[model samples]
Target: MDLTHSAQDEAFRREVRDWLETHLSGDFAGVRGLGGSGREHEAYDERLAWDRHLAAHGWTCIGWPEEYGGRGLNAARQVIFHEEYARADGPGRVNHLGEELLGPTLIAFGTPEQRDRFLPGIRTVEELWCQGYSEPDAGSDLAAVKTRARLEPVSEPGGPRQWVVHGQKVWTSLAHLADWCFAVVRTDPASTRHAGLSYLLIPMHQEGVEVRPIQQLTGTSEFNEVFFDGARTDASMVVGAPGDGWKVAMGTLGYERGVSTIGQQIRFARELDAVVALARHNGTIDDPAVQDRVTRARMGLEVLRLNALRMLTGPASATPGHEVAIGKLLWSTWHRSLGELAMEVAGAASLTAHAPPYELDDFQRLFLFSRADTLYGGSNEIQRNIIAERVLGLPREPKP
Candidate 1:
């Protein structure tokens, strides 16, 4: 893949940089570097307003089609935007689940009416969303989801049918703040595993839904446990046909690991830079071993960016292949190591909380939270299995 930017791409990069530099000032100046993994509880309301500001200026869904109220930017341009956004230390995005994951899935598989109802909200950052794939027993084995939803007719003679849902979803990121959840449910009670599943878009504001924040080592509550007891949505809210949920759910996972990963790498680069600076400040840079590890970290980051760009250049498909699994494995492992390095550089200082309420400095939070990097999203074991069975065409593991 060509690594050099063309004249037009450079111009687009400059435009993105300039806009962010200009607007991320004044009242929004305080929001810089606020909100991210393990730090989503910071200045949430202000960051949310910043997201809406991006929406009002047509920057929220740049990769989406123009007809869907997006700028329809190409892959290169989108990468430039994400890179510039991170370089500017822009606040973490609050609507990413809606804009990146759910929006793309709907555009690819949703009905026309579904698109009309949901696309505008996502594009405008007015309606936030969360994923409902993982359950008590279905973390990485998503097909093991036990959440059940069956169609029930409304009392009115001509009223629409509703899907009454019941189950528990854990590690549901931002569910307490989300307006909707696109869940994979067992629509066919008798069918097992990946079959008989359906993707349903359920509303969040109802009596039967409960969201309890799951506090973390960082003393933040971004992930959540969500319980559904007879929660309901219109039957038409199912994205694809009944028993097609496995397909739709897989598409959403593909999008989750797609082009946006470039942005994450950019952010990781910033974190690494900070760690290096800390090393220099603490006189750890003079240590031969520390210097060697820092060089390796830099090289690993470059490799990650190259792999992500190569994946982006490939033909787009709804079902992600082994490349996505490979990317996940690489980054999660690298990041967890970086967290360990951060603690080493910080020395004894990393052991103390910043204040009384279990407050943590940036490095402390990074060190603590990155420990789970390999676990959440998809575990290292699960990703390895995907690469082996799906990409290498190895014999599938026997199920008990």
Candidate 2:
């Protein structure tokens, strides 16, 4: 794929840069750099308002097709937008689950009715979404999911039908704030493993559903335990045919690492810069070990960027295969190491909270929260399994 920017691409970059510079001032200035991985709880309301502000200006979901209320930008322009957004230190997006992951999945695998019903809300940031993939028993072993969803029979002539869901999902990011959840549940009671699973879109506001926040190592509750007790959505809400959820779910995973990754890499660059700056300020830069680690971090980040570009070289809508696991493994391991490096740079001061009630400084929180970086999304072990068994065409690991 051509990495060179054409005149048009450069012009688009200027447009994104100018727009962010103009709008991310005055009222929006406080939100600049306010929310990210460990800091998502910071200025949330302000950042949400800023998200809606972007949606109103046709800035959200720019890569989506125009008919779906997007700008229908090509991949190059989309990268430019994310790059500029990160460069300007724009606040972390509130609707990434909706806009980046689910939106694309629906576009690729969902029925036309699904698109017509859901795309507008996602485009406008009127609805927020949370992934419902991980469960207490089935985090990386997704096919082992035990959550069950059964279609309710029509009670009377022409009465509305719905699917009743019952199960618990753990580590549901942003579940407390989401209006909807796209989940994988067992639609067939007898079918085992990857078969008989269906991807269902369930509403979060119903009485049958409950959300309990899980406070993390960062002292924040961005993740949650979601309990669905007879929760109902329209019978037609399943993304693909029932018992075909494994495929649709995999498609969503493919979209998980998409164009927004460019912005993420940019954020990582900023974090590395902060670590280096801290090392300098505290004289840790004088340590040969510190200098070497920092240098290695920089190199790993470049490798990350190049790998991301390679992963994204295909059509925007393509469903990536196991090759994408390589990217996940690399970024997660690199980030976790950066967190450790951060604590080292702080010397002994890293051991304590900055204030009462577990207030951690930036590096402390980074160190704490990033410990899960390798665990969530997909575990490092899981990624390696994918790379080995699928990408490298090696034999599968022995199953007990």
Candidate 3:
């Protein structure tokens, strides 16, 4: 699949690496890094700054079509971008909800007006978006969403005729900081699951919308409980046709599981290197068993990076197929093991956030997040099922 870059691709890679190295200088200083690594108040713009910086140079949406503020680079360039960004320790892009989930869906299904309205903002980090799929009752069973969106007349005096939304959404990430949210609302509850749903882009700060952050064990308010009461949106806000929401939403999830993954997969590869460095410095490498563990971890990281690259090259369509399932599952399992290795390396220092004698204090926090890796973004169990039924063509487990 031409994994080896052509001369032009090589030149492009060199150019990107040089640009990123020069602009994103080492030691993040004010950056504070990704996901609040157990430090300060998160300085909201730290993430935003990174996205804007990338957009300003037209580097943020590298793989996007040139018509929509992108370089239209090839898959190889995309891989180079991910690799260089991680090498530079670049901060996470804040436009993720827009770029990763909403923007791509718009490109595939949106009207010209929809694309014109949202894509430019997404490029410049002007409009932020959050997903509103999960609800109080429909956490993993996404088709069970009860949020209702009824059509109405534009001039009802009090009643919303455009689209009156009445429902609750929980565990919405970045809801407070977002400009909009792409929600799945039930237009016809009587219809069977995965039918009669409408995908609507709701303005987050409007009158009927309420966003209250949900605190986690980490003492952070990253996720929120969002409620909508009489939330009125224009009929134009519906993504694709009313009853075709399930299909449109499938497009959204596609980008979420695939495109958004490029940067993150590289980031975790760097984490494995950190684990190896810790093991080497902590004197544990002197023990052959620990040395073998470090070697195994390194091999696992390389396999993940290579496999992700192979997947990216094969398809433009982003379905949650067996390859993605296997990649995610391996990443989660290997990541947790690396975290445990780091703990062993740091010993008592690891428990206390790795200070003085120990290096960076964030490994433990990463370890905690890894524990949830298998749980979030569709659990490992679900991935196993996909691999079994879809990839292996195995017989389904007998139903009760």
Candidate 4:
């Protein structure tokens, strides 16, 4: 792929940059670089307002089709938008589950009615969403999900049938703040593994549903444990066909690794720059080992960007191939290593908190939170398994 941008692309980039510079000031000025990964709890309401600000100006979902209430930006322009957003240190998006993952999945697999019902909410940032993919036993082994949702008649006469979901989902990011959850549930009890699963759109505010925040080592509750006693959605709320959830869920995962990753790498670049600056301040930059690690981190980031671009240029499919797994493995490992590097640069000071009430400095937060980088979003082992089985055409792992 050509690395150089066309004049038009450059012009679009400038437009995005100017808009961010102008708007990410005044009331939104303090929100830059707030809310991301382990730090998602920061300025959440304000960040949400910032997200709406982007949506109001027609900046959200730039890659969705124009009819779906997006800018309908092509691949190049989408990349430009994300890159510029990160360059301006835009607040971490609170609506990504809606915009990046679920919206695209719906567009690809949803019925027209489903699209009309959900797309506008996502595009306008009026309703927030959380993913219900991971469970206590099914984190990386997504196909092993045991959450069951069975359709039953509504109590009101002639009302629509409802999917009564009963199970628990752990590591549900931002569930407390979301209005809805797209969950993978076992709709067919007789079926096993990936066969019986269905992707159901569940409402979060109902009495049968409960969201309990899980405080992390970072002293924040960005993730939650969501319990569903008898949570429900309209029977028609399932994306794609009922038993075809394995396909829809995988498609959402593909979207999870989509064009927005370019922006993510830009953020990672910023984090790396901070680490290097810290090293310089602490005189660790003069140490050959620290300098070597920093240089390696820089090279790894470049490689990650190139790989992501390569993936973007490939055929647009909901089912991501081994390349996605490779990218996941690359970035997660690199980020975890960068965190360790941050601590090494901080020297002994990393051992202590910066203030009372257990306030951690930026470097400390980076180090502590990044320990889970390889754990969540598919462990390194899982990624390797994907590469081995799918890409290398190796024998499947034995089912125990």
Candidate 5:
């Protein structure tokens, strides 16, 4: 909302800038955000260290209350923090599922016991989490999830309610490293697609649960196919309430769409810098067409930041409505286009092992990954349908 930073914000920005200058380097690029990144133990270890350092400095979990080991900053300050971090080329890949999804869910819907138990560890990156939303069949049609959890009453004195779960979850990111996964499991089939579901925190390393990595086209094993033959969890792990899984999962999706992807805008900006540098170094910047494309990419990156901020500031009820769809489509298209331009700018030189740092296979990596952006977080087609029916008030398609 505040387009211009106040003096305090400017000073805070400078403080961040000074720290980054000492910490990061000219080639300080990393896996912009968490994905199926290569297993670099050193990178992971360094990232964990950075998260702890940032958390100690009140820079991690920017939106959380001070009680939860955050700075209690306003959304404006949060934006400034992201902007400053980006400018200094120092963003982190620290525990998105925890900070963005579970942390907020705990803040809004979790009991005090859950919050006190979970929030602090998330800050410390001690308890990692992954989403167990997608199933063998349910992707966009998430309400069609078949993972089943049957509630069992605990017999021991003061023991928790227990749930025995059985189902398969696919595309669960970091399930191998995660201690817990927040999942939507079918509790009652007779209730309906949207009802009779429940959210549960299933332990990953338990005996009945088996996790196999999903080897990505990128040759990295970041996602997994997890099977729960008879995974049992205490009743305390249910997120919201029994049969409230759809609602609780909606909260997660809301976090995913609006805030989870919030880190990408600036990271893309940094990527844009690399692309532009590659173009300039390869003597393509002087080409009028190349310059035009580069400038457009820069503008698109800026627009992405503003759009993501707008989405974050808006209400949960606003959701993935038409306006949100438009933003996403534009972001997805521009993302691919930027990668294309990077390849073009690099030309045959990109084929050389001695290509400039920015001209390396980064664009190729992104190009492959970019193909999936529009498809994930709900397909662009789904977003368009939402826009038509909700934003444009268009008639719905006929039922088959």
Candidate 6:
């Protein structure tokens, strides 16, 4: 929460800045500013190589413990690193679901064997991961998930015991590219709602697993429909005890709203800068309405930054606190509005694609992609419910 950085922190910032400046040239120069939420397919291979290069230099997962192949940095240093990374226009990371979400979950709840087996791959970018929580029927209400998994009966002593999974997960980002999926499946047929759920680490390459990319408004397929028809994984792949997955899944959600979001906010600021520059170029800055909205966006971004810091400094828990929901609501709404503002700045030109291939330009892509910002990662309604029930201690909404 300290706004002022100590000398050591300043030194770390310089280190990150210098490293990014030196390495983000030559072979990796083209990767700078490439790849993000809606544009995950952009420079796919190159961005991946850049991510691995960061790993080689001991830069990825700096917040994790040193024993777990990370720098084990404190919150301040992690913030510094992300800020510098964004300032340098570093490419969007391909392994965020692993390093930011799953790796932390494993370190918090996994067995030593699980950590040993998976952390290395995540750190080295040898294995990419996707979340299998949202379903066709359970997008926002994750507890309504119907995906099922049952144990394959052990044939003999020491014989392999596996879990046979059946069901589908929708809005599974990067599933087409992931090597594994950490899924929430109904482990007990009799259980309902949050009960009987198991968080299983399922392999993506085997038979019975299918990933069909979903085309988005941006004309990209980062999200996918993942069908698990009798997909099997080792019984040991479960993150928590059978039927205790709700807790573990919530833990992952908490991490999903973790410190890594600082980089995202920084990226938002960059987008705002671009929008402001566009308005200036197009003479829209002279309009009173445009000026008022632009000023409001700039103010909202600062408030968003401070809220993030406050959330970070507040109590840390395995499950998310109300702060997480508040943060989600704030950032998502702000980014979505920024997208709207970008379109307003573009005016008539926003309706047209650039050229032969008719690709969407930067503003067009931003406007299209930000439309989902409020809907994904839990919707605005979901966040408001969390704040109401959890923060204000209001009565829970009646279950359907």
* Clashes found in each candidate (C-alpha, N, C closer than 3 A): 0, 0, 2, 0, 1, 0
Q: How far out, in Å, is residue 192 in model 3?
A: 3.3
> Per-residue lDDT tens digits of candidate 6, residues 153-264?
6677667889999999999999999999999999999999999999999999999999998999988999999999989999999997999898999889988998888888
lDDT of 5 by residue, 29-110 (tens): 4522422233322266567666666667666677787787766776666667666666564545557788878887777778
Q: What Cα-based lDDT does every candidate model obtain?
A: 0.91, 0.92, 0.76, 0.90, 0.74, 0.92
> What residue runs in model 4 are displaced by over 4 Å at the alpha carbon?
156-159, 316-319
Stretches > 4 Å off in candidate 3: 25-29, 32-41, 157-160, 315-322, 353-360, 395-400
For candidate 3, lDDT tens digit of each residue in 221-329?
Answer: 6778999999988889998999888888866765676644566667776776777677777777788888888889878877877777777776554444457778878
Stretches of candidate 6 above 4 Å error?
154-158, 315-320
Lowest summed lDDT across 10 adjacent residues in model 6 is found at 314-323
TM-score of each: 0.97, 0.98, 0.88, 0.97, 0.85, 0.97
Error of 6 at 181 (Å): 0.4
The prediction achieving the highest TM-score against the true structure is 2
Residues 198-316 of candidate 4 have per-residue lDDT tens digits of 99999998899999999998888999999999887898899989899998988888888888999999999999999888888879999999989999999999999999898888654
lDDT for residue 17 in candidate 1, whole number 0-100: 93
Q: Candidate 6: lDDT of 157?
A: 61
Local lDDT at 99 for model 5: 82
Native-referenced Cα lDDT, model 2 = 0.92
lDDT of candidate model 6 versus the reference: 0.92
TM-score of 2: 0.98
Assess the local accuracy of residue 335 in candidate 2 as a C-alpha lDDT between 0 and 100: 92
lDDT (Cα, 0-100) at 88 in candidate 4:
92
